[model samples]
Target: MSPNLFFQIKILANITELRSLIIVKQLLNSTFLYIGTFS
Candidate 1:
């Protein structure tokens, strides 16, 4: 693949990873809050 295309793919992968991480963090926080309320 061309260097430019490779670089673009890498950036896209990084962005996807970052988005997933944020989503996971939000899910964890909400789960904790839900359990806390029950207790």
Candidate 2:
């Protein structure tokens, strides 16, 4: 495979990882807020 293709794939993988991390962080924050308010 070409170097460009490898780099592109890596970039895409990083983006997907970052997206998931953001989603998980947001979920955790929301859960904490819910617990704080309701508990």
Index of the highest-TM-score prediction:
1
How much RMSD separates candidate 1 from the native structure? Answer: 0.3
C-alpha RMSD values across all candidates? 0.3, 0.5
lDDT per residue for candidate 2 within 1-39, as digits (tens), equals: 999999999999999999999999999999999999999
Predicted structure 1: clash tally: 0
lDDT of 1 by residue, 1-39 (tens): 899999999999999999999999999999999999999
Query: How many steric overlaps are in each model, in order?
Result: 0, 0
TM-score of 2: 0.94
> What is candidate 2's CA lDDT for residue 15?
100
The worst-scoring run of ten residues by lDDT in candidate 1 lies at 1-10
Error of 2 at 4 (Å): 0.4
